[model samples]
Target: MTLSLYNTMTRTTSEFKPLVEGKVGIYLCGATVQGAPHIGHIRSGVNFDILRRWLTHLGYDVTFIRNVTDIDDKILHKAVHENIPWWEVAMKYEKAFAWAYETLNVQSPTYEPRATGHITQMVELMQTLIDNGSAYAPGNGDVYLDVRALKSYLTLSNQKLDDLQSTGDSEDSFKKDPRDFALWKAAKPGDPSWPTPWGAGRPGWHLECSAMAHAYLGAEFDIHGGGLDLIFPHHENEIAQSESAGWGFAKVWMHNAWVTTSGEKMSKSLGNSLLVSEIVKKVRPIELRWYLGSAHYRSMVEFSFEALEENSINFRRIEGFLIRASEILQRTPDISISEKFAAAMNDDLAVPTALADISDLVREGNSAITAGDNQSLGTIAAQVRGALYILGCDPFDSVFASGAGSNSSAMDGLVSLALAQREAARARKDFAAADAIRDQILELGIIIEDTPAGPRWTLAR
Candidate 1:
């Protein structure tokens, strides 16, 4: 089936046709590098990673760009609060976000451009906007986009220019219209400054993305993506500035829904944010990724420890099934993704549907285990691994292999010692002692099942 995606610009789901027949270019708005990442921030990364993987799986040569805003006002503010250089502050959290992405198994983008490194591109684009009469310098070394002058100003956001509020990135007095936003902010005292034709200053938040996208993906690209929160002023401004400069910036726009807590958007100000590092301690990284990507990309995920633990336990069941199947087969099985899973993925990355298909495979695999049907079990195991591989949750995949099973060598030894004691008590006809030991292991969330091969242990559901 041909891939289809929901375009935020058109507000519809349609077939995806890349500008180049077999090549796809995607530009994703990446982190601002002001603070450590929370699950809210990483959700976008995981959702897009699935998109990239599916596209690649379909034989498309995908060039993905995820940019970093290293010179943002937030970064400078954080530097002040931490008593460090602004660049140091940016680097610190940039590393933190990188670690978080890696831990969650998010594939690295083909190119990750930093705002500071692309000053020349931003300057050139601003000059193009000025020459095209779509921007003004205002004699203060600051450049502002002429919001009222553009014939297609708010089309992406589906808003009327007259009804809009002030852009807020610059002083209203600096703009021809209060609604106009900053293309360049004039340098202030003790702030980082880069030389530009309009004197010394830094690029605005919106300009960094347009400049980098054009520099890397040319005048037009396949898809531009970010959180739904960016649908407003940020992405809208990108369209205004880039189109005014005579470039078809992005053919399609995609925005993933927010991760919310108590029906409120997750943010530091809300005091309900869960950092990736801390959350990983409570559950495995792969389980966290699965939970984050479980919902459709366009749906909100309500954050709750209860829900997260439930999903993680469900994932362990699937992982446990795959492990048992592997042991029965006595060798690694070949991967073969089912058509139903692919069709669901093709339909606008319908992850929940694809996951449901995975659950069905698990159920069938379990039944095969019950019937001792090794031939059928092997095929089902391969299909399960293939689906999990697409979702980045394959238990045996190198990224998650280290933490694949609960029964590691140390854990196995301890459980086995306890089981040995129970066996000894049973041999001596001490039924009470055997039952007590069994109860203790059960309290540790381990279940021991006796088979003709001997007693076997597994983590309790």
Candidate 2:
């Protein structure tokens, strides 16, 4: 069956046809790099990573572009608050975001262009809009998209132009309409500025994405993705600025739902945000990725410590089955994603359904183990591993085994030595010593399970 995806633009699930057959170009609105990344911020990364993986699995040469807005109002505010240069703030948080993405095993994009790095592109785009009468630069060095000039200004957002509130990006006195969003902001005292035809100023949040997308992906791209919250001013403004300059912009729009907490959107202001760094310390990073990516892309995930722990346990069950099956087979099975799992993935990335299919296979593998059916175990293990590989959760994959499972090789070596000691104590009928060793291991947040084959060790939630 052909892959189908929900296009936020069409408001329907449609067959995915790339602009260039066998090649998919995807532009994802990436981090602004104002501060450390929260799980909410990384959700888009994981969701799109799965989409890119699935496309590649189907033989598409995916050129994924996830841009970083390294210069923005938030970065400047953070710099002033911390008494440092704005670039310092951007670099600090950019490194944090990079670490978070790596920890979650989100594959690196084909190109990660920084907004600050593409000021020339942004200027050229603005000049095109100005030449076409779709934008105007005030004497103040601030340029604004002429919302009234574009009949399709609100097409992506599906809202009447007048009904939208002012972008509040600039003073009302300088705007043709209060809703006209800024394409460029005039240089402010002590703010990071770039030289442009209009003046020395910085690129607006929305303009950066359009310019970066065009610079890398060209006039039109296959898929544009981000959090659903960007539907309004951010994405809407992108549509206006790009289309007004005669570019087709993104052909398909895909949005992942937010990660919320306590029935409210998760944000730094809520005081309920969970940073990726903090959560990785709680559960293995692979387990965290499973928990985040298990939900359907378009569905909101309610962030809860309890739910995260439960999901981690469920993932361990699957991982445990794979480990046991590998031992029995005497080799790691190659992933051959099952038809059912592929069908679900093809149908707009129904990850929840795909994961359920994985669970069913695990159950079948367990039953085969109980019945001593080696043939069935081998087959089931391969299917399970294939499905996990598509989801980027395969335990045997070196990516997760090396990075997510443990902190360092030295720590792993220490744990291995301790596990061996515990096993030796058990072999010698030293029940008290074994129990004490187990307790010590548990205190270190490591789980040791005794099975017929051997004692298995994993990080505990």
Candidate 3:
């Protein structure tokens, strides 16, 4: 089957035909970089990362651009509140985003653009709009896009021009219509401002993306993506600005649903919004990725601590199968993975279904091992690894690749200390001391089975 994607632009699923024959261009809207990224951010990144991997698997060179909005109101507010510089705030959160992405196994974007660094390109685009009579600047140095000028201003949003609600201070008097959003905001005292044609000012929230996307990806791109929450005002305004600027804008618009807590929207008001760091401390990282990736891309993901604990448990079963399979490989290894899972992945990147098939293969591999069929077991294990790797859920990967896992160095040191105590007791003919060491190891949430084969260890169940 040809790769088919549900395009929000067309409101339908269609076979994906790239602009270039063997290449894909994807632009995903990244975060504002004001805070540590939560699961809401992870949902979009993981959902699209799987898609990018699938496209690459099918022999498409994907140039994915996920931009960072570093110069937004939130970043400014955070800088003033924390008594830190605005750039410092952006850098701190950007680092946090990178840390979260690595732990969650979300594949990095091909080009990660920061909005602040692209001011020249933004100014040039605003100049183009001004020359084209689609935008104007007031006496106060504030620039606004004239909504009445564009023929297709509201086409992407599907909202009537007049029937729109917006919040701004100079909105009512400056705008010919309330729906006409800002292209640029004039500089305020002590605010981070760039020198522009409209005096010293900063680009608006919506205009920054338009400028960045056009500057890097040209007037048009193959795929544009982000959270469903950005569908209104943000992305819609991007389309208007680009399309009105005489560029084709984006061909396809893809959005991933939010991660909610307890069937309610995760918000500061609800006091239930959990950070990625807090959640990762409680659960394994890859298991958290699995929970976010279980549902279809457009479906809302309900998250909770209890759900994550179950996901972590389920992941262990897969990991245990991999550990056993690895031993089978060590003995006699001539295994080739099946491409049937690839076929499923090509069907719009159906990860959950592919994962289910991998589980079935694990079951088959286990039964075959029981029947002394090592060859079949190794082959199935190879295929399972291939599928899981594409899904970013490789079970063989160390759970604590980063410091995010429950397996801390402190805990490991304690385990080794207990083991050393046991050895010391054995040397001194102190069986009681050795037994006490063994008990101490158990108390630290580790199982130590002293087999005749040698000492063996695993995390406690």
Candidate 4:
């Protein structure tokens, strides 16, 4: 099946035809660098990473761009609260976000541009808008995008210009129209400033992404992605300004659903305790990635410790089967993606259905193991690993070899010792003792199964 993605612009899932065939460019709005990353922030990263991986698997040359907002209002406020330079605050949290992404095994983008580094490009973009009369400076050094001058506006958000509210990005006194959004803010008394034709000021949040995306991906790109919360003012303003400047902007807009808690969008305030660093201590990074990427990209993930634990256990079951299969085959199984799995991934990135395919393979592979069918086990294990590789959670991948909860070799040895005790009880005709030993292992969430070869232990689902 050909790839079909849900385009937020068209409000339909249609076949994806890249502007340039076999070459795809994607711009994903990255971290704002105001604080450490939580599961909610990383969900966008993982979702887009899956899309990039699938595109690569299909032989598309993918150039992925994820930009960092290094200088923002929140970063400045954090700097003031921490009694440091705003740049220092941005660098600190930016490093924290980088570490979190690496820990989760998210692949590095082709280019990760910082908003502050591309001030020249932003100034140039603003100048184009100004020359086209799509923006104006109101003598206060603040440049505002003239929403009324745009030939097309609010197409992505599907909102009427008359119904739009004030952008609230700058002082209403500085804008000729209340609906006009700021392209550049006038320099403050003691804030970072860049020299532009209009004045010495910094770019707005929406302007940074538009400039960075245009700078790296040229006038237009294949896909633009971010969280659902960005669909309104952020993305809408981007379209209004970029198109007014004679650029096509993004061809397809993909917005992932939020990771919610108690039916509220997960924010740093509500997700402070759920930081990636804190969550990794409870579950392995690979397991966390599995849990985060399990749902469809457009589906909301309800945040809860109980749900996380259940998903981690399910991942371990797959991991255990792969480990046992490797031992039986005496070598790592080669990756072999199944047709059903590929089809599921192709259909709008339906990760849940793709995962179900992997689960089915694992189940059949376990049954093959119990029946001593090495050939079938090898084929099924290969397919399972292939499917997992696309999801960025392949057990054999070196990225997950030595992180938290990766002591699988030691776990196997300990389970083997317990199985030894159970075998001894059964050998001595002590059925009661054997049953008790099995019960103890089950309490630890490990299911011990006696087969023709020996006792196999897997994490209970």
Candidate 5:
């Protein structure tokens, strides 16, 4: 099946055709760097990481851009509250986010640009908008986008001009129209400022994405992605600003749904936000990634402790099958995923369906094992591993191998020694000794299974 994605702008599922053949450019709205990443923030990372992986699997050279808003009102506020420099606050949280992403095995983007580093590009973009009359800089170093000048100002948000509320980004006195949003903010006392054509101020939240995306992905890119909550003023303003400057902007606007708690958006203010660091303590990083990426990207995930535990158990089942199959085959073999799995992924990244296919394959693999069909077991295991690889959850993938809840090398050696003793006892026909050794291994949280190949052991889930 050909790749198709839901474009937020047109409100329909459309076939994906890249601007440049065999090369796909994606711009994802990354974290704001005000605090440590929560599941809500990292959901976007995991969702887009899956998309990037799938595209790479399809032989596309993907240039993925996920930006960081290192300078923002939230960062400044946190700095003041914590009695530290704003840049320090941004850097600290930025490192935390990077750590979380790496721990979860989310692949690094081709370019991860920070908003503060691209001030010159933003200034040039503002100057272009000002020259084109779509932007005006008040003498006070504040610049506002002329929303009325754009023909389809709220097309992306699907809202009328008068029906929209003020962005509250800047004081209303500086804006010519109440609906107009700030492209740049004038400097205030104690606030971090940069020299620009307008004045020594900073970039607005919306303007930074537009400027940085243009700087890296060029005038037009294949896909622009972020959380659904950004569809309104953030993405809407980007369309108005970039199009007014005669750039094609993003071809497809993809927005992932939020991770909610108690029917409300997961947020720190609500006291329901689950930090990635906090959750990883309960479950391994690979399990956490599976839980986050299990749902369809466009569907809302109501966060719950029960659901997380359940998902973790289900992932272990898949892992258990791979371990048993590897033991039977004596090695990890190459894989060819089912066609149904590929079709599901190509259909707007229907991950839930793709995962269902994986579950079916696991069932078949287990059945083959029970039937003592080693050949069938190896084939099914390869298919399951292949599918997991596409989803970034493969057990043997180096990323997961380093951090998963697997036994350490020393533990492996110790288990092997115990198994060798058990083997000697069985060879001597001493059933009592072999049973005692098996019981001891079970007490140590290892499950030893007698198979046609040999005695196989795995850490009990």
Candidate 6:
């Protein structure tokens, strides 16, 4: 089936056609990395990761580029607070982000360029704009894009020109127009500085993606995505600068909605934002990822302990099936993945529906287990795994090795030890000890539930 995506630029769901016949180039806006990432950070990554995985599965040579805005006002502020250099701050969090992404199983992009690393590309792009009259250096040694010179400046957003704030004009001391945003900022005291024909300064927030995307993915690309919060001013300015400067920019634009907390927006002020590391300690990393990948990409998802709790429960249900099937089916049969699952995913990455499909397969697999039909269960399990590759859900893993409850245990030993402890805890009327052992089991990404047949545990893939 041909994939279809909802283009934010055209505001329509159209069948995806790669600019190059068999290759797809995608540039997704990555986290600024000024602080530890939150659950909200993974939604866009998870959605686009699925897009890349599905396209690759369908025989497309996908080149994915996710840029890191390592040089930003926030990074500078953080550096000053810690009494460290700005580069140190950026590097610290960049490593943290990579660890979190690995934990969530989001695929690494083909090119993950840092804004500071691509200064030359940014300078060249800005020079092209100035030479073409779409941008200018207005005597302050800083560069700004001229909004008035570009006919399609605000076309992507369709926001009225009068509605934009004339407020951000520190560069060139008030660019040609109030809405004309900065392309480069002249260096100030105690901030990171770089050499450029525009003088000693740094790249602006919007300039990095335009430069990096052009540098890595060519003039035009297949898909561009980020959080919905960036559609305005950020991506809109990208469209203005790239199109005005003659790079074709992107054909399809996609944005995932924000994650709300307790019926309010998740923000620093509320002090309710759950960092990825903190939540990883509470539940399995896969559970945290499942919550992010559980909903429709375009829908505004709420974040709460209750929601995560519910997600944790649902993830355990699916983990239960994968575990039981692994034990009951010693000789698995060759399986063909279902096309209906593919169709659901191809439709704008309709993940909620895809998740429902996975649930359906789990129910069928469970029934097969009851009837001792290993062949049917193995076939369905294979299909479920193919679907989960798109979801970044690791349903069953053979090497839940390192982060398991303990370090020094053979596969047979870990399973046997856990079961023996469970029986011992149950006989001693030691419910607290029993619960502690259960948590120990979960830390290994293995879930145990007491059943009428007997106490059973499943490895969370």
Q: Residue-wise lDDT of candidate 6 within 82-199, one digit each (tens)?
A: 9998889999999989888888888899989999889988888988898889998876767888888888666668788887766644534446676778899889889888988868
State the lDDT of candidate 5 residue by residue for 257-330, as single tens digits.
99998899988888877999999998888888999998999999999989999999999999888877886677
Which prediction has more favorable TM-score, 1 or 6?
1
Summarize candidate 3's per-residue lDDT along 184-216 as a digit string, tens digits.
888999998999867898989888899888877
lDDT of 2 by residue, 50-155 (tens): 9999999999999999999999888888899999988899999999999999988899999999998898898999999999899999778999988888867677
Candidate 2: list runs displaced more than 4 Å: 166-170, 402-461
What is the TM-score of candidate 6?
A: 0.88
The true-versus-predicted C-alpha distance at residue 267 of model 1, in Å, is 1.6
Q: Model 1: how large is the Cα RMSD against the reference?
A: 2.2
Runs off by more than 4 Å, candidate 4? 166-170, 269-273, 403-450, 455-461
Residue 51 in candidate 6, Cα distance off native in Å: 1.7
On residues 380-456, what C-alpha lDDT tens digit does candidate 4 reach at each position?
99999898899998888888876323458989899899899999999999999999999999999988888677787
Please, what are the lDDT tens digits per residue for candidate 1 over residues 22-46?
9999999999999899999999999
At residue 185, give the lDDT of candidate 2. Answer: 95
- The TM-score measured for candidate 1 stands at 0.94
Give the clashing pairs for model 1.
Answer: none
**Candidate 5 segments whose C-alpha is farther than 4 A from its true place:** 166-170, 402-410, 416-440, 452-454
TM-score of each: 0.94, 0.91, 0.87, 0.91, 0.94, 0.88
C-alpha lDDT of candidate 6 relative to the true structure: 0.81
Which residue pairs in model 2 clash with each other? 335-386
Error of 1 at 108 (Å): 1.2
Clashing residue pairs in candidate 5 (N, C-alpha, C atoms within 3 angstroms) = none
In the order shown, the candidates' Cα RMSDs to the true structure are 2.2, 3.2, 4.6, 2.9, 2.4, 4.4
